[model samples]
Target: MSNLPTPAEIIAKANAELNQAYRALGDARDWLLSDWDVQPTAEQAATIRRMREAIGTAKDAINEGRP
Candidate 1:
């Protein structure tokens, strides 16, 4: 018998991967914001804000479009 994954299994795997990516982004965000004793410089703060927005956009896309 064939052992190939079914469509549902493939989709489940993809969703799991996407969740992992989202988690990694969160971890990076936490590290950038809290892992250091010193505050980020203005440029660094701006970049972090951009990164946060991007993560929020990704979350919205995942919530709105995921199967």
Candidate 2:
């Protein structure tokens, strides 16, 4: 029979996912910041910054194994 993952293993998986999410969010922000014919509005830029911050918060929680 296959052994189930322990709590530590589960947290590790969640942390990996959170790290990926953070990276993806950062990539999006970078793309937004890149030069383009049309640029994001002030509000749009602010929203992207907020989204990145939220992703950072999630990464922190996952590292801490918060419920």
Candidate 3:
């Protein structure tokens, strides 16, 4: 048998990795907003917003037609 993953397995792995990344992004956003004590500069805030939007788009793509 070939040891390669099937398409379902590949999609599952991608979904799992994206979830981990989303969690990490949340942690970083929280730290920047609260734990760091110092306020994020305007540029930093904009970057965070962009990251959030990008992650949201990724989620939509991965979950496009699942039950």
Highest TM-score model number: 1
lDDT of 3: 0.70
Candidate 2 per-residue lDDT over residues 1-67, each given as its tens digit? 7599989999788778877776776687677567868778999889877877776776676557643
Better of 1 and 3 by lDDT: 1
Against the true structure, candidate 3 reaches a TM-score of: 0.55
- In order, the Cα lDDT scores of the candidates are 0.81, 0.74, 0.70
lDDT of residue 15 for candidate 2: 70
Worst 10 residues of 3 by lDDT: 58-67
Task: Enumerate residue pairs that collide in model 1.
Answer: none
CA error at residue 49 for candidate 3, angstroms: 7.8
Clashing pairs in 3: none
Per candidate, the number of residue pairs that clash is: 0, 0, 0
Order candidates by TM-score, high to low: 1, 2, 3
lDDT by residue for model 3 (1-67), tens: 9999999998788878767776776676565456556667999889867876776675576457342
Which candidate has the highest lDDT of all? 1
lDDT of model 2 at position 25: 68
